[model samples]
Target: MRAMTYDTYGGVEVLSETRIPVPKVGPGEVLVRVRCASVNPVDWKIMAGGLDGLMDVVYPVVPGWDVAGTVEYVGIDTPEFTAGDEVVAYARKDYVHGGTFAEFVTVPVRALAPKPASLTWQQAAGLPLAGLTAYQLLTRLDTGKEDTVLVHGAAGGVGSLGVQIARALGARVIGTASARNHDRLRELGCEPVEYGDGLAERVRALAPDGVTVVADFVGGVLDTTRAVLAEGGRHASIADHTVLGAGGQWMWVRPVGADLAELGRLADAGQLTVTVAKTFPLAELAAAFDLSREGHTAGKIVLEV
Candidate 1:
């Protein structure tokens, strides 16, 4: 199998393309013939040793968590899927080793979901991590039709999906982004607010009573969140652990097949979608990482395998 690997934690310069043996399927796992994989900031962060204390890593690491592919083989006792079934998954394992940035990846049955028929392979590749992040956060907050939600970093991968998911839940969404992405937010059924100076006022202008729920995808916005949250409002952050000190939850997405399936159902029902900002061939994994690190892409960056 052709895959990108890094021998040590560093930067993109350390990544190299090489041929390696196909990974073995264990019980409760399935081997996926990789069609596409999506790049998230965590991929590069893990590569650079940012998560050193959180998860163990093996050398010659293949880095990627989001996969959209076909099942080529299923392990003994894994009856949830079989050969030729299309699937998508947030395939983060307990340790960082074999990953989705290759010709094939072994996915646990717990993280596997049938691919949404309405999405292309590229779009499906992008949905797992970002969609799960938004879905979990909003549902944990119990976001509902009566609530007004504010989404920080509204045009990025997770926030973009956050906007759509909030809308699908019938909540009124106010998303913060640059003017360039404001129209895109509107198309996703969110009221767009520019994210610079006076962000709180901008949000307040949209909802005079302050927002009922806040989902912060971008870090460093706890103050703005405080300023715009209604009394008894719920809030959470995927990026900022500091949120834990402010009566909010610091969330990490879990790979649950049932949650991913619900996201797929939303996509199939035309209530959700993923935007592909750009894509690179499997060998260009480093370039994809560089683009995601720039922190300006409005949608998911993907790798076509």
Candidate 2:
């Protein structure tokens, strides 16, 4: 099986396309013949050793987590899915290796969900991680009717989804983005605000009493969150851990099949959608990573296997 692997952490220069043995299916896991995969910020961060102290790195590491494909074989004792099932997964394991950017990859059943029929392979591949982050953050905040929510980085991958999910759940969303993305955010049901020196004021102008929840997808916005949060409001950050120091939740998305299935259901029901900014062949994983590193893609950057 050909896959993207890096023996040592560094830049795109370290990434290489090579043939490695197809990973074997183990109990409670399934082998997926990859159709497509999506790139996330964490992929490049892991490649650069930014997560060295946290996630253990295995040499010759394969570098992706989100995938949509067909199940070729199911391991013994895994009864949830079988051969020929179309599925999607956030395929992160306890350690890094045997990832989704390959012709074939093994996936634990816990992270697998039936692919939404309404989405294309690239769209399904794009949904898992970002959607999970957005949905889980809102869930942790207990977002609902009559609440006002602020989303930082509102036009980026996770933030865009956060805005949509908030609106779907009956909250009025205020999203922070550049002037160029304001119109796009409004179409997703958010009132867009430009991020910078006076973000709090802009957000407050929309919700004078301040928002009830702040979802920080972009880091370095603790002050903005503070200024625009209502008294006793909740806040969470995927990028900034200092949120914990400031009495907010600092979260890393987990691979929950049930949670992921909910997203799939929403997509199939036409209540949710995913945006694909770019797609590259599996051999061009380096270019895909480069695009993600640029940090300005409106939606997901995917790899077609």
User: Which of the numbered candidates is closest to the native, going by highest lDDT?
Assistant: 1
Q: Estimate every model's Cα lDDT from 0 to 1.
A: 0.96, 0.93
The TM-score, computed over Cα atoms with residue i paired to residue i, of candidate 1 is 0.99
Query: For residues 37-154, could you state the per-residue lDDT of candidate 2 as single tens digits?
Result: 9999899899999989988877789999999999999999999998999999999999988899889999999999999999999999999999999999999999998899999999
lDDT per residue for candidate 1 within 1-305, as digits (tens), equals: 99999999999999999999999999999999999999999999999999999999988899999999999999999989989999999999999999999999999999999999999999999999999999999999999999999999999999999999999999999999999998999999999999789989888888999999999999999999999999999999999999999999999999999999999999999999999999999989888988988989889999999
CA lDDT of 95 in candidate 2?
91
Clashing pairs in 2: none
Give the Å shift of residue 189 in candidate 1: 0.2
State the lDDT at 79 in candidate 1: 87
